[model samples]
Structure formats: C-alpha cells, structure tokens
Target: MKRTLSAAALVLLAVVALPTAANALEGDSYGPGSCNSITPASVARGAAVSYSCSDFWVANQTVSITIDSSAAGVSARTLSTVADAAGDIQVSIDTAADPAGTYTLTATQGTVTDSSDFTVLDPADAAAAAASASDPSAGGNALADTGFAGTALPWVAGGLLAVGAAALGTVVVRRRQQA
Candidate 1:
C-alpha cells in the first residue's frame, strides 16, 4: 500500500510540473525594457513604418530612434525627436527608401528604452511568410524569437504521466490480488 501511494504521489507531482515547460516563451534576447513597438508590426518593401512611445521618463525629453537593417546596402541609422508635454512621441519611417528585410527599431529616452521588430518584404512574399509563421509545421513562432506559441512538449508529458499512472494502478491491483 505504501508503494502504491508513493507511485500515485509521483504521478500527481509530474502532472502539476509538466505545464511549466511552456514558460520558454516569456522574454526576448534583449533581456527586458528594450522598448515599446513599431506600429503595424510589418510593412511591405517601399512602404512606411510608424512608431510611438508615451512612457518617456520625462516630458519634452529627447528620444532617439535607431534602425538596424538586415538588408544589404542599407546600413544602420539613428534619428532623434522630442517627446510632447504629455510624454508621447510619434515618428514615421519611409520604408520605400530602405531595402527589403527585417529591421530592429529601438527608441531611447534617457536610460529607459524599448525595441520592436519591423519587417519589410515584398507584397508577394508577405503572405507566404505570414502563413509559415503561423503554421505549426514550419517551426511555429518563426517571426518571434520568444513567447508561448508553439510548444507541445508539456501536453505530451502530461499524457505520458496519465498512462503511467494507469499502468501503475493495474500493477498494484494485480499484486494485491496475489497477496
């Protein structure tokens, strides 16, 4: 009976612990407080991209905008603007003038900063890319480096734990009958 109880307890612990495997989708490579975001998330090649921030540490503060492009010929660029009296600032980028690829857009005010990923692709390529990013077979979360989107290992473990418990129960009953 003690052995059966121990086995049941182990199965309960495993079921509770399996769900935590999904925690891998939490943060990004930049640690935290990288920046806010770029509006629209993505844009076609030769289009425009916009971004805003309202969490500046101070009003009328100067925030720097930096674009680090992955496309060839188009190098990294940095620009600056001042936040309004309400600590909000809006800026736009002429993607039409830039190359086609992914770019990292970061905004900085004083030591506080935020960053977002902006993609510039041809219209024809955008749909396929979007489909693949959302498709589970093609490495789900392809566009995002972190966040909980495509993890199934936890559920698999939970199922396995249930099977093991059932098998253990069967074995316990058989042993009790023999005794």
Candidate 2:
C-alpha cells in the first residue's frame, strides 16, 4: 500500500510538474507581448488610448508590432526593434485619430504570433458602448441576438448534454438478479 501511494504521489507530481515544464518551454500560451491582453483598452473616438505590450523572446529572434484600424481612417505607430536579452519589446498606440470600432493589434516574434483586439469607441455609439461594456462579445451581434455573440453556446451545450445522457444510460445496466 505504501508503495502504491508513493507511486501515485509520483504520478500526480509528474502530472503537475509536466505542465509547468511544458509552459516554460512554450513560453506564454498566447505568445509574447501584451499580445494576450489589451489593457484599459477603450477610449473616446478622438481620445488617445496609450497602452503597452510586454515582450518575450528567444535567441536570434526578431520581433515586430503592428496596430491598425480597418475602419476608413485610423493610424498606428510602427515598432521594429531587436528584443532585449529578456526579450522585452514595449510599444504604445495613439488611438486619438481612429474611428470607432475594433482594431487589430498583432505582434510577431520569430515563429510565435500573437494578437489582441481593442476597441476605439465613438462617444456617440451609446448603445454599442453600453453593450460592449456589459460584454465585450456583444458588439459583434449588434444586429443579431442579445447576451453577447455567444447566445448560441447554451443550445450547443444542451445538445452535448443530451448526447451525454444517452451515453450514460447506454453504459448503465438495470437487471434483476435471480433471487
């Protein structure tokens, strides 16, 4: 029993430690930079949104940052710099002149690619602004259903539940044993 417990402990320890090792090797799951996050991201249409991206790196790697708006007229600063020893590449954006909509923020470092979605809110988009503040995914469904763009997730989930119930019942046996 002691041996079995020790083995179990080792197995659990390996399971826990393996992910850490893999994560370290994989760096960040979403890759380098604030690529995984867009902080304090919303601002008035003509108002400036100053933000930065944290960096990540490997030896001899190249890093680039691009921020742009697909909404008619918008601009972003270009940052092309060699990563620091720690792979730090910081950048800022001036959203003051951009239109009101979501913009793409992409960072490329060697083989790793990361992106974050940010919104430039027009002071006039009150309904959209409110919906977005309530739920970020709501903006995409402005013409569709409520409760964000994932209003269908529950239905899909229900279907999965029904399938799961059928499978469970199939695996269970109810038979009267000879008395």
Candidate 3:
C-alpha cells in the first residue's frame, strides 16, 4: 500500500509539473509575439488602453496592431511597430475617437496572432437614470430578475426531493440488511 501511494504521488507531481515545463518551452513563434496581455478589459467610451506583447524568438520584427470596431461609422485602424531586443513591445491605444461599443484588437507578426476584446460604454442619460432610480421596477423586469421563474423552480425542487428520497431509501435498505 505504501508503495502504491508513493507511486500515485509521483504520478500526481509529474502531472502538475509537466504543464509548467511545457508552457516555459512555448515562447513566441518565429513570426508572432509570444507573451501578450492587456490591462483594463473594459472602459468608458474614448479611453486609452495599455498593452504589452513579447516575441522572444523574433527579435526586432515588425508587428501590426489592428483595431476592429463594431460601429459602422468608425473604420478599422492598424498600427505597425518593430519589437525591441528580448522581443518586447509596449503601446497605448487611444479610443477617445472610437464610437461606444466593443472593439477587437489583434497583433500579428507573420503567421502568429493574438487578440483582445475591449468595451466602450455609452454615457448614461440623466433624466432616464433618475426615473429608474426613483421607480422600483423601472429599469429591470421582475420576471427576468427571478431567473428561474414559472415552473422551473418547482421542477428543480421536485428533482431535489426525488434525489433525497432515493438516497434515504438506499441508506435504510443497507441498514436493514446489516441488521
């Protein structure tokens, strides 16, 4: 039993450590940036966002950052820059001119690609906001708030009861058999 447990522990340790090793080996491709992340996932309309991406294998390679907007009035924009030594690039995007909506930003070098989503929210209206705050049911619907309204709750409760009864019956049967 001790040997078996030791073997199992070793297997578990290997399973956990393998992913970290694999991830460390997986750096940027010869074409695309490797380590990339964006800060502040959502923001007000027309705000600046910061992003960093690394292309360790492809040092000094040019990368293109493209911004695609859902709003029709605004056209997609692209910016290009070369990565620094150690394959790192840092940039800020100016959203102030973009319309309020979701935008996808993609960075590409050759065949490698990484993308992030950003949100721009519209400013709230004063009178409409005031009316909703004053009225208890103004902004939100009662039916939607309940989530599992109508017959759903009842069916869920009945299902729980059935499961409980089956578990109780199994316990009782096992006890009678032991007795």
Candidate 4:
C-alpha cells in the first residue's frame, strides 16, 4: 500500500510539473521582448528602416537598440529609447551611410535581448525588390520558409511524458498484484 501510494504521489508530482516544464521549453523559442520582425525587411542602401517590438519591456523602461554588421568598414550603431505605456518600442534608423550587407538589429532591456536580421541591397537589387514588393504574389522581404512550423515540439514532449507515466503506472500495478 505504501509503495502504491508512493507511486501515486510520484505520478501526481509529474502531472503537476509537466506544464511548467513545457512552458519553460516554449519560453526558449518565444520569450518576452523577442523581436518579432522588422518592417521593409530589405531596404535600399540609403533608406530608412523601422521596427517595432512589444511585451519584453516595462512602461518607461529604457530600451537599447543596436544595429550590427560584419561588412568591412561598417561599425555597429546603437540607439536608446524608453518603452511606452503599452510596453512597446518603435524606432527608425537612417541607413544612408551603411553599405550593402546583411545586418542584425537587436533590442535589449536589462537581461532580455532579441534580434532579427535585415538586408541592405545595392541599387539594382533594391529596384528589383521594390518591383516585387508591389506585386501581390511576391512576398516582400519575408523570411524564407524553413519548413518547421515551430509549435509542435512542446506537444510532442508532453505526449512522450504522458506515455512514460502510463508505462510506469502499469509497472507499479503489476508489481502490486504480484506482491
């Protein structure tokens, strides 16, 4: 009877703990203040770019924005602003002096940081992108579909946990019957 109670207690603990573990895993992929996207994801070498992010900051908190590039002769640029009451930060940066390259835009508030990538194109490519942007069929500056929908892993993990718990319960019941 004690063994049965112990087994039951263990199962109950696992059942209670599963959701918290699943949430932690989900948080790794979709944490607060994660940069969702940047508007006009591709831009002409000397155009303005804007991005908005929310939920990663508190009202009136100072958020630091950084644009970093690995292109030769380009230095990282940094900007700071306060989040609004809605805990959102939006900023526009002029890339007039930035050369054609891929850049990462990051936001930081205290310990939380998130980043997204954007591209700056030469005149010829920029014109092509602009032309495509106007076409309804062309998804302008969208991230490439990597074929992973990103929402399945947590469910899979939880399912596996449930299966394991069932197997353990079956073992415990069989042992009790044999005893």
Candidate 5:
C-alpha cells in the first residue's frame, strides 16, 4: 500500500511538473509571432491594405517583409523594417498595381516568422467585400481564424486528468480496504 501511494504521488508530481520543465527548456527562444492579420482583407485594385503583427519578435530588431502571390505574372515584393519596442510591426501596401488575386505577406526577424494572406479584388468584388466587412452579421473581415474555436484538445486533456484522478482514488480505496 505504501509503495502504491508513493508511486501514484510521484506520477502525479511528474505530470504537474512536466509543463514547467518544458517551459524552462524554452528559455529565451523566440517563438513564432502570432496575431498576424491584414485589415481590409479584401481591397479594390487601387486601395491600400494594412498588415499588423504582434508579439514573438526580437525587440528593436530589423524585420524583413515579403509579399508573394501565386498569381501568374505577379512578381514578389520585398521590404525591410524594424520592430517596435513591444515586438509589433505594421505596414501598408498599395494594391493599385497588383492584379486581382490573393497575396501572402511574411515578416521575419531573427528566427521568428509570421505570415498572413489578403486579397486584391476586382472593383465589383471589392464593393461586395467592403459591404460584408462593414456588416458584422455578414462575417466581418476575412482575417485568418487562429482561434481554438473547434479544437478537442482541451476536452481530451480534461478527460485524461479526470481519469488519472479516478485511478489514483481507486488505488487509495483499494489500499484502505486491504488494510
């Protein structure tokens, strides 16, 4: 009984300590930036679109920005800028010369990189897109959905923890009965 309880306690301790240990191993390493988004995700041919990124950048470091499109005859564009003290970046690019298509904007600093996609629309489509963006009921802007909206990982983790607790309780109860 003593051995069983000790083993269970050790297992529980390891489970709780694992996350902390992993965090320690990640010390000072810049993770990839997130909250990468483009405002006015869909734009008319001559409109200006804004790109913004938050977090995960090395402070005050130079960041390389690249805009690439898979559309035929569209050459890639490159620019360089520095991230602010809070590791955030924002830029605007004119879509006047860009053909109607989807473009991906990537920002890289040190080992961290983030990317977002926006669309340059034809005049007719751009009007429709603008209308949709203005109406929240129409689903708002077309920013990438990076949320945990439909993930099952949380449920799985909770189920596992509950199972572990139940198993430990069963072990303790069995030990008490045997005593």
Candidate 6:
C-alpha cells in the first residue's frame, strides 16, 4: 500500500510540474519600449521618399522622431515626434534626384534606437527584402543566445529535490514492508 501511494505521488507531482512550452507564434519578441525596422521607404519622382514607423512602436508610445536621408538630401521635417504601434513609419525622400545607393533609417526615442540600411533596388528587390524580413531569424531578439544563459542552479536544485523525495519515499516504503 505505501509503495503504491508513493508511486502515485511521484506521478502526480510530475504531472503538476510540467510546463506548457510557449511556441514562436505565441511569443512576441518585441516586448515594451523596443524598436523594429521596416523596409523600402517609398517615394515618387521628386516627392519626398516615404519612410514609416510600425504601428507597434507608434501606438505604444508618443516618440520623438527625425527621419533623415543625407544621401537623398530629403528629410522628414515634421515635429519632434511620431508613433508607430502597428510597426510602421512612412516618410518621403527625393527618389528621382539622388543616385541609387544605400540609405540609412534611424529612429531614436525614449531609450530605444533602431536603424535599417536599405538599398535602392528595382521593385524586384522588395520581394526579397520582404522575405528576409519575415524570417524569424532576422528579427531583433538575441537569436543565438536564449534560455538559461546566466547562472543555472535553480533548475538543478529542483531536480535534485524531486529525486530526493522519490528516494526517501521508496526507502520509507521498503522499511515499512520489512517491519
């Protein structure tokens, strides 16, 4: 009877201890006061090349923004603020005048700073860049280093405690049976 009770307790404990792992879909890499880069700041012939901040950033905070492209000689001279909560920011630049080259997108507000270096490729480039953007590996979070980075003793101790409890229960059951 004691052995059966001990085995049942261990099974129950294991069942309660199990944690549901959060998959990539359920997790949001951008959590609070973080910035992201969106691609292809579009523009017409002479109109200001358009740049945008994501709604994720805009809707989350009222941020100070200055979108400038020295290479294109065009800038977003709006007020010192913009918001992108859905993870988008749109501003315009001189697409016709400036030669095709890489341009920098810098947004700094609060404690977050984000930058994206985009190339002036034909429309074909948009699809490729968009594909790369969609990849989970490309997003901002630390990819190579995740989970259990710093000191990892708590887990070990917990496992040892569970094992000790099982062993003690087994010993008690054996003693009772012998007596």
Predicted model with the maximum TM-score? 5
List the pairs of residues colliding in candidate 5: none
Worst-scoring 10-residue span by lDDT in model 6:
38-47
Give lDDT for model 2.
Answer: 0.61
Rank the candidate models, highest TM-score first: 5, 4, 3, 1, 2, 6
Write down the TM-score for model 4.
0.63
Model 4 / residue 130 / CA error / Å: 6.3
What is the per-residue lDDT of model 5 for residues 1-179, given as tens digits with 9 covering 90 to 100? 67677767776776678667867755645364465588977788999998887766767999999999999999999998888897888888999999999999988777767788998989998888778877778989567568758676786598579758866786878879889
Report the C-alpha displacement of residue 139, candidate 1, in angstroms.
13
Local distance difference test, each candidate: 0.74, 0.61, 0.69, 0.81, 0.81, 0.54
For residue 157, model 1's alpha carbon misses the true position, in angstroms, by: 17
Listing every candidate in turn, what is its Cα RMSD in Å to the true structure after a full C-alpha superposition? Answer: 8.5, 9.3, 11.1, 5.6, 5.1, 10.4
lDDT of 6 by residue, 1-179 (tens): 66767676775576456532423333466354333353334422343454455444545455554434555555543334556546454544444554445556666666766666545544555555666656778663434556666564776577668767876777777778889
lDDT (Cα, 0-100) at 165 in candidate 3: 67
The residue-by-residue lDDT of candidate 2 on 3-29, one tens digit each, is 445554665575557657766855656
How accurate locally is residue 1 in candidate 5, as Cα lDDT from 0 to 100? 64
The superposed Cα distance between candidate 1 and the true structure at residue 11, in angstroms, equals 26
Give per-residue lDDT, candidate 2, residue 53. Answer: 43
On lDDT, the stronger of 3 and 6 is: 3
Per-residue CA lDDT of model 3 for 1-179, tens digit only, reads 45445554665575558656767655544344455566666665566787787553257889898989878887899998788887788889887787778889888888877788877665454345445656767764333345544875675576557655655665566668679
Q: Which ten residues in a row have the lowest lDDT in candidate 1?
A: 26-35
